[model samples]
Target: YIDFYNNNRIHSALGYLTPAEYYQQSILQNVA
Candidate 1:
């Protein structure tokens, strides 16, 4: 059972990346 909004979810508003991925990318971009 998965909570679609909380897990295994990809957001189109974030360019189709998962929330975790989107956050990680933002951090990397800021650091670089």
Candidate 2:
């Protein structure tokens, strides 16, 4: 069973953003 909770699918924990998106946003924030 693939755990598509937040990591692969929309996660309510991260404001409905996937892990990749959240990570990318974090990186972008740091860069700026």
Candidate 3:
């Protein structure tokens, strides 16, 4: 499912952070 993938997919380029976590951190960084 898309939701499962978004929350669980690990990104090697992102230091293995999940897509959801990576996006969340990116947004926070951008806002800061």
Candidate with maximal lDDT: 3
Model 2 ranges off by over 4 Å = 1-7
TM-score of 3: 0.77
| lDDT for 21 (candidate 2) | 84
Identify the candidate with maximal TM-score.
3
TM-score of each: 0.74, 0.65, 0.77
Model 2, 2-22: lDDT tens per residue?
A: 546546788788888987789
Question: Which of candidates 2 and 3 reaches a greater TM-score?
Answer: 3
In model 2, state the lDDT of residue 26. Answer: 93
Q: Which one wins by TM-score: 1 or 3?
A: 3
lDDT of 1 by residue, 1-32 (tens): 44566346888999998777788899999999
Backbone clashes in candidate 3 total 0
Candidate 2 lDDT at 9 equals 85
What ranking of all candidate models by TM-score puts the best one first?
A: 3, 1, 2
